[model samples]
Structures are given as structure tokens and as C-alpha cells.
Target: MKAPPFEYHRPSSLDEALGLLAELDEAKILAGGQSLLPLMSLRLGRPEHVVDIGDLGILDSLVVEPDGSVRVGALVTHRQVETSAEVAAHAPLLHAAAPMIGHRPIRTRGTVCGSIAHADPAAEMPAVALACNAAITAVSSRAAREIAAADFFEGYLQTVIEPDEIVTRVQFGPWPRHRRGAVVEQSRRSGDYAIIGLACWLDIEDNTITDAALSFFGVSDTPIRVAEAEDVLRGQAPTQSTFSAAGRTAAGVLRPTSDIHASANYRRHLAAVLTERGLAKATAESGETR
Candidate 1:
């Protein structure tokens, strides 16, 4: 299948790209094209104008900002992010979650901001962003704003971003060195979309967990943060029984829908089982599990 014919604009500047997006109707911005191109090839997306921003060098950066956050530009490829030392040290959850997205070739061309903008409910990046409380920068010809990850994703494949706005950058705050991160995804096979995935981290001090994060994907319209489970695990010493109870709490509070890939009840079961295993794996990785 081939993409529908469209007027293509390769803008060399961010301002020019913004102008193209703002002025054109049904104009889609192309970053790495790992997500949009496939849909376009299948005629799932038919943009009248294709604004290619790949040459905008201003948006190709991958850096650790002065505020101790890892900032990824719209053009930074997944492979760059996956192998970044700054990402590994500052945002370990994202570092661990990167490889779970598709395969090496896809990651080599995929952009982080593009995936966030796509807002696939089953995607791992959203789960990592939600768990890390990441910040996203949105820009348009007229305005710019920063949106928190929690407020950015509205539903499955839907976001708060206006059609004219482009996701310019994504920033992830530094995770402490004492914190240990883990992402557990249940897919039928490697590189397949997860049936259910869990991304979590534990902050341990004095052999006791002071903080914990539990975010899930593939079970809802958006990444489900298991706040109830986090609350339960905050003060409790990590034991199999304690983790089990928290998993049950998470399963009870979640509202998952039945889909072709999995049933609601089956997803709920994965949520419970993965929650326990994810927490234990993260806690043990921190070397503070008692």
C-alpha cells in the first residue's frame, strides 16, 4: 500500500515547520516517521500536507538539562535515547523501557516525542512518562506551553495537543541513584505489543522503601498509575505477602475493558501478578529488599 498523494514540505527551520503546521489543513508533522509513515502507507492517515521536520537541527538534541532532567528533542531517535548515558543515569525507567518498543531498526528511526504524541495506550513510553512525571513541551506558530505527562494523554491515541501544535521536547526528571527501576511487559513474543506491561521504581533508604511508583499499560485507555498500590507499599517492608496484597488492591481499583487481545478479567489478573513481580524485581534490584 502507498500513502495518498500529498504536498510535502521539508522545512529546514523550526519556525518554518511551525508555520506549515499552523497554516495547512490536515497537515501532519513528521519526526522520525516510524509511527506516522506506517499508518500513512496503509492509508489510515491521509494528510493533505506532510511537514517534514527531520532537518530542523534545533529539534535533534538529546541532552541532560541544567535542572537535572533529561530532555529529548523531537528528532532524537529511540536508538540514541536507548544508548544515552544521561538517560541511563537520570531516567533509568525510560532507559529500560526503550528497548521494549518494536525492534532495533524501528528504534533506530523512532522518536520519543513522536511516540508520546501518538499516545498509543499499549505503548511503553507513555507508561514510563507517567511513572516518571515527565514534562512535555508543545509549540505552535502562535504559542508554546509545557504539559505534564499526566495531563498530556487524554485517551487511546488521543492527546490534549491541538492539531496546530507540535511536541517540541520531552523532559524527564532525574531519578535518584538509590532508586531502582524495572519494566515488566507480558507480550506473546519479543518486539510484540505487550498484552499488559508494568513500569515501576522503588526508592529505598536505610533498607526501607521510602517511595514507589507503579504505572501500567495495555489494560486501559491510558497509562494507569496504581496509586492505591503505591500507597500500600510505601511504608511496608517488602515481603511476598505485602506485595501480594498491594497487587490485589491494584487489580480491584482498575477498570479495564475487554479487547481482542485480552479479556478484562485476564488483564486484571496480569495487573495483579505483574504488580507483585515488578515491585519485587525493582526492590531487589535496589539491593534493599529485606
Candidate 2:
């Protein structure tokens, strides 16, 4: 299916893009267009105008700040994040999750900020952002503001982005040393959207968990940071029993919905199994578990 007829504007500058968005209330910003085009083709999204931000060179940059955080422009593709040395060194969790997004072609054309803005509950980046405590920068005609990952996602396919705002960059803090893990579920096909997924990071000291972040996707209205599970794991020496208990806690706390891909019960089971496996993998990777 082809997209509906719409006026297209290619803005060369960020200011120009902002002005266009401000002027056209029904305009949608086009970044990678991987998600937007699909929706448009299906007639799910009909905008009066399409504002293309592809030519804004500043939004295409990837910079590592002095504070060890990696700043990813909204236009950066999944492939870029997957292969970035700075991202790999500082935030391997993002690198690990990037390749799971989709096939090479889709990743090549999909933008990181676009995925977050689309807010697919099942996608990898949103969970990664939540787990890493990333910050998102949004710009509008009036002023710019930074939103933390926790507050950015409001519900399934919904976000805090106002109609006239554009997400410009995503800033991710360095992964805590001594912990990293990622897991996903798909049916016998690589690049398929996950039926369920999990990612975890742990900071360990003296054989005890110091800090931890655990995120889940494909089983909730939005990517969820399992705070109760994290709380159970923190300050505990990682043992088989502790891991098992934490997994159960996470499974019980999740509120999943039945869908075409999976039932709520099945997703809850996956959440438990994945949590145990992910935590174990993270602990081992961190060398916290012998």
C-alpha cells in the first residue's frame, strides 16, 4: 500500500524543522521513516505534511561526552549504534541489543530516536534506554527540555512528545562496570520482533550486588523497569536460590496481556525464565559469580 498524499518538506536546519512543525499542526517529522512509513502506508497515520529531518547534519552526529556518556543523534541508525566503538566500550548493553532490532536493511533505515518516539513496547531500544537510565532531548519552537527515560514513555505506543516537539538526541550513561546482559524471544526467525525480551545491568562489589537495573518488554503496555526485582537482587550475593527467588518475584509482579504472539501466562513464564537466565549471565559476565 502506498502512503496518503501529503506535502513534504526537507528542512536543512534544526531551526527550520522546528519552525515548520510549529506552523503545521498536522505535520509529522520524518527521520528514518522506517516506522512512520509503514504506518502511513497502512493508512494508520495520515499527516497533512511530512517534515524530513534527514538533511539536518547536526542531528546525525554521534558524540561521546567527557562524562563517559554517549550522545546519539536522533538520525543515527541502529546499525550505527551496533557498530560504534564508543557505544560498545561504554554501553555494551546497547550494542548487544541493537543487532536484535531487525534485519540489516531495516536497521540501516531505522533511527534510534524514531523507535523511542514510536514507543513500540516490544522494541529493544526503549528497554535499553530504561535500563541505562538514558536521557532524551526534545526541541520545540519555544524551548528545549531533557526528559529522563523513566518519564518519557507513558504507555503503549504513547510518549511525552508534544505535537510540535521533535526528539533531537538520546544521551545514555555508561553501563555500570561489572554487569551486562540481554535476552529476547522470537519464533525461529532472526530479526523478528520479540514475543518477550529482557535486559539487565548489575554493579557488583565484593561478591554482592551493589546496583542493578532490569527492564522488560513485549509483556507490558510500555517497557517496564522491574524495580521490585531489582530491589530483591541488590545487596544480595548472587546464588542459585537468590536468583530463583528474584525471578519468581518478577514473574508475579508483571501484568501482561494476551496477544496474537503469546498469552499472558506464557509471557509471565518467559519473564521469569528470562530474568533468571539474564541475571545469571550478567553476574557471570561481571565476574561476580564464580
- lDDT of each structure? 0.87, 0.86
TM value for model 2? 0.95
Assess the local accuracy of residue 239 in candidate 1 as a C-alpha lDDT between 0 and 100: 78
What are the models' TM-scores? Answer: 0.95, 0.95
Error of 2 at 73 (Å): 0.5
Lowest summed lDDT window (length 10), candidate 2: 281-290
Please name the candidate that would achieve the greatest lDDT relative to the true structure: 1
* Residue 48 Cα positional deviation in candidate 1, in Å, after optimal superposition: 1.2
| Tens digit per residue, CA lDDT, model 2, 99-144 | 9988999999998889999999999899989888799999999999
Alpha carbon deviation, residue 44, candidate 2 (Å): 1.2
Q: What are the per-model C-alpha RMSD values against the true structure?
A: 2.0, 2.0
Number of clashing residue pairs, candidate 2: 0
Candidate 1 weakest ten by summed lDDT: 281-290
